[model samples]
Target: MKIAFVGKGGSGKTTLSSLFIRHLAAHEAPVVAVDADINQHLGAALGLDEAEAAALPAMGAQLPLIKEYLRGSNPRITSADTMIKTTPPGEGSQLLRIREDNPVYEACARTVRLDGGDIRLMATGPFTENDLGVACYHSKVGAVELCLNHLVDGPDEYVVVDMTAGSDSFASGMFTRFDMTFLVAEPTRKGVSVYRQYKEYARDFGVTLKVVGNKVLGQDDVDFLREEVGDDLLVTVGQSPWVRAMEKGRPARFDELEAENHLSLQTLRNAAEESYGNRDWERYTRQMVHFHLKNAESWGNAKTGADLAAQVDPAFVLGERSAVPQPS
Candidate 1:
């Protein structure tokens, strides 16, 4: 399953993402955690300090190599530079297997030690001074977008991503890529407003989204969330001293976590697992093709001087498991 954690800034999406990854890992499940946020703090939320987290390879910095490797022997693609982020995988392209060793993971991911178990972590990296006024954060996120587009996961394997806050995820077709999205919302009006934005934007697509209420102290807080998001609310997490300790760099085990909070995490895991389906894979391919053509028409054709729309092999549904047939 491919899952995304998103919400308003400071809504603790990173914390929930880290906890969920650790939960899945502790159970001996195969899971990968990708930090797609421009802020680059999911590593810290997991366990890494300032220096350690910064040392992991940033996917954004290694875009060319990834494109080159995934481009594989596909005859449709002439060069890595011409393969935009929205490029869909087709016959002869190198597809990714979840939790399996691959060149992209080798170049960009790292193993993080959590008390419960362990997780494979990757980040899009932080926006740097060099990128100041020159690149949008989406350019960095493009690496992750392309990675997800080519990735194929089974029922047991999981990929959990910490997405950029709020409606910003709607900026790219990446928003439509997840099997499920957990939008963390606080009780405040500002937090619920983001929920409205996500609900409105994702409703048109087949995006499966649920609201996870964060930092609730009482029934009133829960009521506020229910009223704002209605049936979209999946579960609520109360403030936890255990989480506070984790935030301070003190380690924790799931056994020691607050009982209710632990249960809430399990609920989230169940929701994600239940969301797995064979039906959505076709739509995933179309979204990639749609964005590719949109980008091609807007700028990609001028930039690459080739018809980028030809990159789409209509019969190839990216996340679907089947034999690929070459374009005729």
Candidate 2:
């Protein structure tokens, strides 16, 4: 399952993402934890030392290699310019398996050794001064999206991503790349407001969003979330002293998390297990094509738009609901 955690900046999304990855790894499940946030703190939350996390390679910096290798030696892809997000893998395109022996994994992923089992960690590099006006954060988002598009994970395998905060995720189509999205919302007006915004934006694309109420202090906090989010609220995590200690640089064990937190985590795990299934590749491909064509019309050229449209699988396009109706 490909899962993403998104919420208000300080709403504990990254913490929940890290804890969930740890939980899966503890069960000896194969998992890849991706830190796609510009802030890049998931590594530390997953128990990596600051220096070790900093030493890991940035997946964003490796975008060229990803594109080159995934495209492989396919002669059909004559020019790199045409290989946009909508470009589907051809016959010679490389497929990524998360296991160590897979060439794609060996070349691009880093193994983070945890207590129960090892999990993979990939990060999008932090925004730098050079990128101030030249590039948008979507450049990094595009890399993660393309990599996942090429990856083929088994049923039990998992990909957990800590995405950028709040409604900013709507800036790019990357939000649609996940199988499920967990919005870790605090019980506050701003938090509920973001949830409304996210739901309204994602509803049009058929995205699944489940809200996890975080940092709940008492009944009032839970009540607020219930009132605002209702059925979308899956679980609630109370404020944890153990989590607080960890935040202060103490070595708090995952097993030592508050009981409520553990239950909330278990509930989340069960939800993911129930939701796991094959991805709708046709739907995803159509969505990608739609996004690319929209971009082409607004900022790209006619030839590029035609090239993107040609990459769509004909059968998928025939049944695609991604095209917006034209106004008469």
Output the number of the lDDT-best candidate. Answer: 1
lDDT of 2 by residue, 270-293 (tens): 777666564576777677767766
Which candidate comes out best when scored by TM-score?
1
Tens-digit lDDT track for model 1 on 1-328? 8999999999999999988888888788888899999889998988899999989899999999899988888788989989988888887898887766778889999998766566789999999999999999999999999988888887788999999987899888998888899999999999899988988888888888899999899999999899988999999998898888988888667679888877888999888888885447777788788888998898888888899988888777775464233232
Q: How many Å off is the CA of 93 in candidate 2?
A: 2.2
Error of 2 at 325 (Å): 40
Score candidate 1 by TM-score against the native. 0.96
Residue 174 of model 1 has an lDDT of 94
